[model samples]
Target: MSGTLGPAPGRIAYAELDVFAAYGSFLVQDDTARPDTSRAFITDLMNNLVATTDGAISVGTARRRILPVTLDVRTEAPEDNLDDWDHVTEAGLRITSGRLVVSTFDYRTAIPRTTVPPGDYTARTYASGFDTISDDRIHGDDAYRVILWPGPTVEPRVLKRYPHLPIPG
Candidate 1:
């Protein structure tokens, strides 16, 4: 990912290509593959990389725009004994403009929609943690996250709000 991160398809492609190329194994094709073994790998490598990367693109005479904002949910804790938590994700909206990029995990993407404009968009993300001994008792954090990425210069922000989780005695 670049210094600035968002949902740009081209940037994502470039990033993924850099990552995949480092491996060089995923690009290799079968020995019996057509006239050239590495043909398939080398031919559509860029397009393949772009296509495989999550997000859409729109190129115009003036400028190009990548349409898609990845909604990701990850554990904030180092090694919490929280299991069976639902890191639910849903399609939020699409953002265009700038060379911004955004990603948390080593490999991750989410449902993307091409509706709405660039601004603070609320996404549906929640997680539940339960007590080790008692199944009935629960202690969890359900968050309401808003992604703020208006433009390139603006600092990307993920404001999260955790609702109260009642524990059953």
Candidate 2:
């Protein structure tokens, strides 16, 4: 679990941590360290955005795009798996029930000193189970984009359990 925030389900959503933690691998020279980086609160606040690719929850077809603040992903799975993330990502809501899990919209990267793009580059994850995400999920205040890459982290364990069912190639 990335933190206590992730396990609840849909209320306070979270992505797998490896993506953001990887940032630590980069070493800013002593002189390069920004004053802001020294503050623990600022670091905590940016952690989620840094971890997310685009910032929105995506699934088979990115099933849940506009999430309702009322529905908390923190405690439960979707009632029936729907596209609700689009609503919340675009419109931050006063949550009452479920939590939303959005890694695509929430994740971000820093501008490397190199010629590459200053911030995180878009790289989608590939999966057979999920449908292609819609443009709505790619835009807005808390939205991001990721090309699907083949991996257990992307595919999820729920769909891979059937031994008879071959994993997507």
Candidate 3:
């Protein structure tokens, strides 16, 4: 089965979260504690593109302002579109609860619960516009796409990396 949620604009203004695993049975309610934004943590997050703790699985962003984001769930892995993206990475995520909620760092704006059978899955995150990302302005071209499919947990890998983007650590 395949499903997609949003290429619509989101409320996230930070460069670290475009989509994340929500730790609860409900879509809008997440009971998981937020991860610390330490130098090591941020470095790991940016390098892998997907970072997970017991509480959450976060996908990093290339832009630090509001941008469109999309989430896709598939029955199998999709081909990586490296030419279309500036950065691409993959990681593992286990969903004990069938509810998959895609949202920003804050829960204010979120995609409704996307149901997938509870299991381990691989999440591939694709990001674009890192080359033109700005600290002082918002560029509408920055976007993120996260695709998840059922699979064994594996070490995170960066398929494509943009050298100019800063890694916290």
Q: Pick the candidate with the highest TM-score.
A: 3
Winning model by lDDT: 3
Model 1 lDDT tens row, 72-122: 322121122212332222223234332223321123234122223443222
- Evaluate residue 98 in candidate 2 and report its C-alpha lDDT on the 0 to 100 scale: 24
lDDT of each: 0.22, 0.22, 0.56
Candidate 1's TM-score reads 0.18
The C-alpha TM-scores of every prediction are 0.18, 0.17, 0.69
Q: Name every residue pair that clashes in candidate 3.
A: none
Q: After superposition, how far is residue 90 of candidate 2 from its true place, in Å?
A: 26
lDDT of candidate 1?
0.22
Cα lDDT tens digits for candidate 3, 1-169: 1123343232211122333322210111123334445666456776655566543566666444445556667776775437767777777777776766656546443545556677787777776766665654344355676777778766777888766753421
lDDT of 1 at 169: 11
Total clashes, candidate 1?
5
**Deviation (Å) of 141 in candidate 1:** 2.2
Please give, for residues 1-169, the per-residue lDDT of candidate 2 as tens digits: 0001123323332233212112211111111222233344223223222111121222222223332111122233222211322211111111111222222223224321211112211222222222233344332222222222111222111212212221110
Candidate 3, residue 21: how far the Cα is off, in Å: 14
